[model samples]
Target: MGTATLLLPPRARFGGQRLSQSTARWLGRAHQDNVEGDPVARAFDILPRGWPVAAVTRQRDAGDAAGSAWLRADPVHIRPDINGARLLAHGDALGLTVSDADALLPSLKPLFGDAGFPIDAPVPTRWYLRLPEGAELPVLAGPARALGADLFDYLPDGSQGRRWRALLSEAQVVLHNHPHNAARVAAGRTPVNSLWFWGAGRLPDHVRSNFNEMLGGDDAMQAFAEAAGATAAALPERWRTGEGHRLFDLRHVRDLALLDRDWLSPLLADLRSHELDAGTLEFGDGRRFRLERGQRWRLWRRPIQSFVEQSPAGDAPE
Candidate 1:
């Protein structure tokens, strides 16, 4: 029998901090296999470039593919406090669209373009600061690294850091003073006040992975699979344990009941009946556990009802 590996977001549904009832029960019966991973690294078994490559793949999907060095300048909401500002919401929380982007970008583009970096948003939620070939810039962390956390700790440092920092500051000022922010505040929406810049590099010649078949991920993950000669696509309506090693991204499942119906219930049944050999569940906190068919017989261990909630740093958007 083949193995199924699943990746779960710690905060799935409107800030949900718990897994499904079926998932919790299975975890209690499963063996504590191993917990190892850098939270920023992709689950794919390749030398992942992290966000830069993901952005390139997305840009390609949007019909604006390019080979230039790329940097993600995605929009983010920064809430200032006594210590420093924290990333309030990003990615899907912004609810950006082509029209919204058209409104906010015209003012910000010339600022970066004048400084030799041109900006583009092929998809409303994803913005790019295209860097020229051989351009020298400091390494920066992606918005994912700074989400819901203090922005100061994730800012770039070193000689070129100041230049990038200055550009970021300038971008914020332009956004803050923009005429649309007033409209946004009046409408009770988060203002488009900041841009997080990271992911800088030329696209690699090839993307590699260990799995031959995969399911459930964004365009970036699918692009990587195609480049690596693997089959990737949407998750099916229900679990059908297939041949070869497989990867499943369960983060997109925002509805708890839907997750249970689509995957959790049947999965537990398969493990109990020994239809599958083994399965693994991994969380954003680098915690991984394995469930085997034989483990269902363990009567002494109590089934877990509630899982340990992840900290702010570990909790991710669903």
Candidate 2:
């Protein structure tokens, strides 16, 4: 069996704090494709509007933090036809086309044109892994390590306790003042108006559903417990049965302050007093992360592009 790779840009992980060195690594390996435009442009036109989108760009002035922008116009979308025939089995699997590949190609071209990129082409806009129905899971980067995350170290151990781990980490690239998310925060729009990118993976559908339910609720703790139970029920039996070490679900929430361990532990405890769920709370260093039960950010994982320098001289400039 062969493996497929997905390349996503930083804006896909909207709410997380880490955004520089690691994002640079991924962008480094990225390249623009050379192909036709129609099918690829159609794909972009079809993406769900108001979702947090990420892409490497030749243009540094990409606007909109939660709105979509051009990534690349390269025709890499057609390369799978040459590299591997079976790669494009689904609409979601196709790479990018020439018209928009540039939008996603690393922004480094202005500084260094195609000197170190691996494959410069447009392929699919959204990167996903549609594994064979029952194939062995492919090895991929761990979520915490992927997003410059350092929050999973606090999970409680033992039979009655459960662990929550960061499944995927995405960083959102936003302008200093973009209206999409900012307007929503300033009472100009509601949380419902914000767009978010969440960790990528095949997870229980309820995880996302539970999060959406709390998007506009007043009682966050109550919403959190409901979401927690929903997420717990959605987990594979092994995870639910004391065999899991970590789990986390990112969603757009209202308050960032409620994420502190002290705040969450007590609230979680209070909620569980009525329900016998053994939920424990943990926190991440606020400098790089916000742990609120529901914040306007959901963890989204799409294909992220990282370029590998061909030679010492081709390396991206610091």
Candidate 3:
């Protein structure tokens, strides 16, 4: 609706992954030039890994003698917030009142600064709710979780994509009807986006492996696909939007679907169970809040992204 504002450079690194350096520089220039829209910036940190290469030169020099140099990176889902209410709720979950969350603006640097690689800086701990349409927004901080989603055919076509839209609507319904998630949202618990992670170019093998582990066998895989197709066919036309496609974490695969309704009830019941208690503490004149938990949260521990898409055997599915 408005003139498009670039968020990040087209090539900026997502998560800790190495984005093309040229992209990062372009983003920096955009920021310097006072670009508008969603301010996209890079967050970097040194994650502990199985191997630490002291020098890439020697490794490259070895050539055939060099062992496989592998790098693993976890990706995150990025979204924009168009409304203040969702942003307020996100702040509340992190133990900040909306005003308190808003007040943290001036000290964003020193307070949120980090000391890790790529120049280190504090990663603002907050969840995002992106509207399909872009809009100017206020910063809202909160304890956050993310949902990993893929837009299969999400493009700039005037027509809306049908199947992808139906799947997203279904996912919202499923999440809303579930007592645990609904209650969490009602109580201001920021649900993080379940994002995807990649080691190389293809989908990770662990996806299929995880499904087999959860479903108890591979017999259900094909059946599951058929079931999805049938559900898609039966979906009401009113709910359909044809044009773009999305295949995020919950799009094609979801762990929740693999489990029965009865199986999910107890988990929700436990979160509501009184034995669980959560508390928060604020630091730096209410700039940062730390949530301390005393009870077990089942949904928190489950890896839902793996269930949705089988790791791309050769790059993620389109």
Q: TM-score winner between 1 and 2, please give it.
A: 1
RMSD of each: 5.8, 23.7, 27.0
lDDT of 1 by residue, 1-318 (tens): 667777766533325445566566566666653355543245454443444553456556564555667777888889989998899988778777787788999999889999888988887887887777688844676665467788767767776777887888899999999888778888888888888876666556556666777787455566667767889888777788677777887755566566666776777777777676788777665666677876666655555544454222221222
Of the two candidates 2 and 3, the one with more favorable TM-score, higher being better, is: 2
lDDT of 3 by residue, 75-180 (tens): 1222435421121222223443333323332222222122111111121322111112232212221112222222222211223334223433443343334454
Show model 2 residue runs off by greater than 4 Å.
1-125, 128-138, 142-144, 148-257, 261-276, 281-318
How many backbone clashes can be found in candidate 1?
Answer: 0
Task: Tell me the tens digit of each residue's lDDT in model 2 across 1-318.
Answer: 111111112222334423244333322332223223211111121223221112212111222212222211111111123332111121222222343334333432332232221223323332222222332222222222223222222222343113111111111121113343354347532211101112212222221222211111112122222423422223221111122222332222223232322233333333333321233211121111112222112223221222222212222232
lDDT (Cα, 0-100) at 48 in candidate 1:
37
C-alpha TM-score for every candidate: 0.78, 0.20, 0.18
lDDT of each: 0.69, 0.24, 0.22
